[model samples]
Target chain A: MPTTTRQWLLNGHPRGRGIEIDNDFRLVEAELPDPGQGEMLLKTHYLGFDPAQKGWMENIADYVAPMNIGDVMRGSGIAEVVASNGGRFAVGDMVFGTTGWTEYLVTDGKELTRVETELSPTAVLSVLGTTGLTAYCGLFKVGKPVAGDTVLVSGAAGATGSIVGQLAKIAGCRVVGIAGGKDKCDWLVREAGYDAAIDYKAGGVKEQIRELCPRGVDVIYDNVGGKILNDMLACIATGARVVICGGISRYETGSLPAGPENYFNLVFRRGTMAGFIVLDWASEFPGIRKRLEGFVKGGSLKYQEDIQHGFENAPQTLQRLFTGQNRGKQMLKL
Target chain B: MPTTTRQWLLNGHPRGRGIEIDNDFRLVEAELPDPGQGEMLLKTHYLGFDPAQKGWMENIADYVAPMNIGDVMRGSGIAEVVASNGGRFAVGDMVFGTTGWTEYLVTDGKELTRVETELSPTAVLSVLGTTGLTAYCGLFKVGKPVAGDTVLVSGAAGATGSIVGQLAKIAGCRVVGIAGGKDKCDWLVREAGYDAAIDYKAGGVKEQIRELCPRGVDVIYDNVGGKILNDMLACIATGARVVICGGISRYETGSLPAGPENYFNLVFRRGTMAGFIVLDWASEFPGIRKRLEGFVKGGSLKYQEDIQHGFENAPQTLQRLFTGQNRGKQMLKL
Candidate 1:
């Protein structure tokens, strides 16, 4: 077993919008953790990257508390138990928890959930994990997609949004995806079974949405908020449901000039725009896991993961999500 | 019966934000119309003025069609049936309908409703008309206040807003009102039975809201959108509900520099912001009228009206709504 561990620590907060690699985060070596009573040592196998991590690095409290400087960069990852000391977990058992940006961790078994060995780790992290639950609950609970409803998803190529589109389709709704670049857009329609996809990078998103959704969008699963959300507001059907999953567009830009300008359309359309954190639905997650797994087993739901290798590249992998370089669910296999 | 009827015609649509009285409207004399088969000739007694009328005058179509350049300015009013030809109404019957800015209107009785003789005509327009229905429906259906909820209302001195504050109070909520000046603020707490009132004209509306609602506002009935709405977004409690009733702040601005800036807080707060047209609840208005009447009869609800005289002042009366000059529901007696 390894005697030394590697970690990425929050060096400093990005005083401005964009985060600088070396300035905001630090890499260091530490002694391998010794498990205390009811504790276990975990070796990270794969680390997860998300746009929300950008918010965590900021000096403001959100759904989760802000990360103070010098703390381990808090995150989610798949880890394998290396040592056990009278805990719920045993040595060699694979687990999923907030293992963070570290190669090793010691936990009291409180935050950990044992991984089902039946599915691949990536599958557990992607379709059968929090991402999948977010997509399902946000669609059904907030968006309320009815059969034959026109469901539009922004950031449709991202981890949660990609699953949201498929879930909407499974509910018998016509799915439209808004993605950056032709590659992601084409993959959405061809590989992901989306009814249509709009390349937001090419511009004219408003016109494309209007043309494709002539009767107006019944539900909008929005991951990318800002001007795009503003544009969709103009084209929503009467009594439309807008589920705000994330705001990746403004995650890096600390402040923007404006919010949704056409939000007044909510009154004209008699619509509801709601937002929620997936953790709020934790009590219902067990049911969600079974349903998502059923879809996956039935060959109805498909997912993609862009797994990068190396614990050394964790910071860069996170940056890839902001730049729209990492495709699918951005993951780093250590 | 008068042979000549005075009317206010839409002279032109305001190309800019501000509506010029003489430039956008023209007073003229027209011959009184005779009732045809299934029609009735109604004489206007009191015409109602609303912020929504400003939207109606704009070239853009909203809940209703835009007023044509030469058409009589559309409005709601209490009228008396003078003559009827095989219609649902008889002579001397007091009715309420869209009597517009004309002294006499020939209608097919389909648009008219017989007023209750027990209530004052102004009461029919203020607390028992569409305005009352808007307040009751918006407060109960959209705001969904619970006991102990901190319900904050913007434009609380205005017609719909004043009623919303009272209704929220009746729903067992801690109601705080935001009005323009000291007089209106004093009336809100003293007469309207608000828990507290914020004088927005004093400035620092955001700070005042935070001070008044330390635990954060649970429900917001917003009539003035833009900066004030933006400010309230920052002070919302977790799982808040923001009901969009009107956007009077932007009505005269035409185009604004931005919308709400901190709307993303909706996700962090797990909030829902919704909007609706009161006409959409037309099917339930009968129940709402009974409920409102009960409140008024039980002395749990109070209302104020700024009654202006002369049909010739129709243009000026409508302007009072935009200027914050009207103390309560702005209306004109012919």
Candidate 2:
């Protein structure tokens, strides 16, 4: 029934590392189009913020297409089918997909997946969503933690890192998290079930990791790259598996950051470093969600969301991820 | 038999990179000890110079023990058994093992391997010894080059790199080699059977690799690390496998050198980087040697050895590996 909608359009490519509100994006009022046959109109309930979005904003394409000037910012979100002409979705049905940075969208229903209404919006957007699936697949498939293995996670206080720590603990590994501050580190150890947490803000990250994991880390799930990744590489155990989940540290940089200087340690340690995208495992997401849901119901896995209000704050909320200002899975409620 | 034997002793850990004979080694004359029970006395014939020997000289212990200040310089060589109390060997038997930079050694024969007398010592040391096995397992097991894959090798004119390119070619992959100069690059394509070669000394190494492997490198066998490793990381294909065989570039540095800067590209390409040592595959060396020998015998695999004469030139011959002076497998005839 709405005649107009609001969108945050990409106004320009970032000139440097930081994304500027005024320069990089523009708030616009757009005419709302009606859904044609086989299509449905979605009202975005919440927008998801991820470090990977910064890469999407670059001129080069990665797992997904790059964001271009004059385009609605590319993103994922929890949305509701407000108007439907598609057989796959009905009005009031909740859905999740690449909903972009918009208050509303008309889709052919092919890209969207119907989400469960029983769960709250936070759960749908965080724990039972792509965030949870990434933690599950990356930790299990790539990190491949064995029971009693010492698993180190960078960005330990963030949404995916939190779930990864919990899931690693559930899998019977000793979990250590590296977070930016005392508060986040405390949350990691107390709330997220990490055996230990390193406050990178306090410095001596390498010595701290060495003190805690004296025998060396067996599995590393890295979300923060740059010096953090380098530190982890320095102390990995023989035959260690390093899962390159995300490199939040370098996402906003004009160029890819310097790599782990000790990566040559892989030869000395006879280890493996691998990288993957969650979208690559889309076909098996249903199964991954079911497994994670079981962990949630059993109280073994816990997740948190840091939600902001207003559609206009979308770009600012995304900046929170880079600055480490947001506590958990960053989201914006429109 | 001479009562006195000459040995090169490690005088000191080099204060900086680049081995110096006068500063780091001392030539000493010592009494030749007789073989005891379960032991054999061997006279060195051919000493094999390897990039890995430089790692053994470092203060830290790697796959093998570090060279102590008073210890004879560690090396691998072809030797002939002159005396034996061990049941495993008899007098005049040709054997190969870690003979060190000494004219004679008494060993229990456990570390030694019996080599074929039909093949020349160069073939035994360069194509059938640990060098060849490194190429075999690293290429087939770690690199996993499937038919039609683009295989790129650094140090492509060296002993291991030459064999790696030939092996990759035999495996039905498109082989591109990156070597130091025009002569080395020409030898790689002409003699070693590489599809193409890039002269890294000409500069624009990255541009050359991009031009050669336009679809991107799928299997990268890196013996030389540093900026060259960083270059290859930039243009890897999706699902590429990087086999970290050696880091010759960082061997003599007082500290480990900086690693590949574009390693984050692994995430974008969904690739794998693995490192390994050949000694770990000792159990399978026989099987691997048989495979490599088949290639050599079938005239499909070619190898070249850069042999230097005189025991006094041992340190200088080893230096050839670092300076890009040795044309193929660097060796010294004692």
- Highest DockQ: give the candidate number: 2
lDDT of each: 0.87, 0.86
Q: Write the per-residue lDDT of candidate 1 for residues A1-334, one digit (tens) a residue.
A: 6777899999987644777897889999988767789988888999888787888898674679778999999888999998889978889989997889989888886878889735576777788877898899999999998999999999998888889999998999999999999999999998889999999999999999999999999999999888899888889999999998888878667553258978888888899999899899888987888899889888889888899999999999999998888777889999
- In model 2, how large is the Cα lDDT of residue B45? 90
TM-score (C-alpha, index-matched) for candidate 2: 0.98
User: What would you estimate as the lDDT of candidate 1?
Assistant: 0.87
| Ten-residue region with minimum lDDT total, candidate 2 chain A | A116-125
lDDT, candidate 1, residue B169?
Answer: 88
TM-score: which candidate is best? 2
Clash count of each predicted structure: 0, 0
Query: What shift in Å separates residue A2 of candidate 2 from its native position after superposition?
Result: 1.3
Model 1: runs farther than 4 Å from truth?
A1-3, B1-4
Write one digit per residue (lDDT tens) for candidate 2, span B1-334: 6677999888878634778767788889988877778888889999998887777777664656767898999888988988888648889888888889999888888888887734575677888887888899999989999999999999999899999999998999999999987888888888889999998889999999999999999999998888999999988999999999987778657567676868888888999999987778889888887888888889998888888999988888888888888887888998
